[model samples]
Target: MKNSEPIIKVDHLFYRYEKENVLEDISIEVPKGAFLGIVGPNGSGKSTLLKHLLGLLKIQQGKIQLFGTEIRSFKDWDRIGFVSQKANSFNTGFPATVYEVVLSGLTRKIGLFRFGSREDRKKVDHILESVGMLDFKNRNIGELSGGQQQRVFIARALVSEPDLLILDEPTVGVDAQNVNQFYDMLENLNKELHITLVLVTHDIGVISDKVTHVACLNKNLHFHGSTFEFNALKERDLSSIYGHDVQVITHHH
Candidate 1:
């Protein structure tokens, strides 16, 4: 891919479930090294757009390109890591250690019938360390706090060393203190590892200061620009995006 190409590109996108339109003529671009945050009220097509970008949902209208290739033809699945909102609900009672959970990320590369090699184990350890969960490597996944479990899931996503990481409401069950720490960890990953991040969040205030770019969506994209521009927008403009009276409050750590 060229250095100037966007990591994700969407043009004139539209999606419908049954007969109801969830997304309408959406167009956006996420460039390399971008910490892009997609924020909107509930049922505003935030997750729907994310699903389209990840190729989890069929595109009925418009075009989407990932890493300079059309979404339909993009074959480099290993280059992208995804952590869904339902990650926290994964069989918490299952008999799996943190190490085992993260190691599973390589199942596609290591093969289902085979075991991870020494180098694979090293990679898992390194990823867990990066997420600050190495100390809990041997603990049961079900025993950790919500934030710790989320970090483990992130480690699992990173074990494959993806170039792009997409997270959907990853901070759902995390407490206030851990939520801040979680975003800090993501920022470190973006800056130090150079992994492009696409985060879907409903709490715009928490992520506004952490992201490099912001896109507000409600059936259509209301705003797409630098974080500075997004922050400078008046409440009236933001209210329009929510389709109701609203206020945006940004928090900085």
Candidate 2:
């Protein structure tokens, strides 16, 4: 039962910084419940296009609608949860506990004059449990390793219970072992929690294996389809997009 409705739609999207153009004539569509991955080289407008989806950058040439509604300030802003790569790049010495940081996402629906209600705290607990970070909840964020901190941020993102979750290089600072675990975690979120994931990353080796669909962007959008279609692309084509001799090992289910 494929639905024609889209969770995100971008038509003829473009963004310019003063005199320089970052994205040109870009168009993309993310259908409901799809795990979509964006891959491209550095300075190839990957993050810029992601900002458009988040509404961090305004549309200079086109329209973007999220969840069937136009990109408006009040309605669409809080509905999406963003976990950026910079979150890991942060100095861990920031004096907050992991529990405190994850609990912050509850601010979305929390009312005035109250930090977080009892129900909010309970919801935070549930999200932490889902992300398998319950025991680390009381630990200081700085004391934990990079992988643990990423899990905390993921818990924070899910605390809001968003229908759409956008991750910008979620595996940027982690080790290979943890990176696999991160993708596995996201795969669990997609299957068990059923959250629609849109991720911007340069690591095609990792995302190419996990995502349901791939969107290759290079100042202009190029390809959009199932990962199977991407797997069908020639090695030369893959190397061209990645700018390297890339190889992938996939398992048939």
Candidate 3:
């Protein structure tokens, strides 16, 4: 990717679900390797914007570019890692082992017809270790706490070693202690691995501390810029996006 251009760019994008218009002319330029937090109230189309980035929902108007080329036309999706709220919500009684869950990410590299080769297993092992889950590799999914389960999901997401990672509500089920740990892990990934991260979250407390950029959306995007912009905005602006009175307690980064 060129240094001058955004890694992910959305231009005047519009979308409608059934009869209601969901997103209206949203545009953003996310520079390479930025930790971007997308925040808004419920039903504000935050997740819809993420879907547009992932190419799951097609844009009815304007354009979306991943590394300058249109996202809809890009074929090498393996370079992007996504861990939705569904991955952690899998049936615990199904008896999928931890290693198996993490190794599932290798499916793309192993191809459809062939089973996982020795190299794929080796890669899974490395990823499991990187995510600090090597010791629990054989444990059943049902046995793990929410934090452990989230780490396993992250390992699965990292098994592909994607250049960009998009996490939708990664800390929802996790406890406060592990939420901090997860945020620490993300910071390490962003600083050490230099992976671009786009996070969808409502936990403004944690995000304000770690994320450098922010985007506010309400069925339609309202703001996209540095976190400092959020700091400068009046309390009324925060209330406007939240659709109610919001208490924005800030801190030093």
Which predicted model would earn the best lDDT?
1
Q: In candidate 3, residue 147 scores what lDDT?
A: 78
What's the lDDT for residue 65 in model 1? Answer: 94
- The runs of at least 3 residues in candidate 3 whose Cα sits more than 4 Å from the true structure, single-residue gaps closed, are 112-118, 249-253
| Tens digits of per-residue lDDT for model 3, 103-158 | 78887777654548788888888878877789999899778877788888888988
What value of lDDT does candidate 3 attain over all alpha carbons? Answer: 0.83
Task: Provide C-alpha RMSD values for all models, in order.
Answer: 1.4, 2.6, 2.3
- Score residue 25 of candidate 2 by CA lDDT: 90
Candidate 1 segments whose C-alpha is farther than 4 A from its true place: none
- Where model 2 places Cα greater than 4 Å from the true spot, the runs are 1-3, 72-74, 111-115, 249-253
Structure candidate 3, residue pairs in collision = 44-219
Q: Rank candidates by lDDT, best first.
A: 1, 3, 2
| Best of the candidates, TM-score | 1
**lDDT for position 204 in model 3:** 71
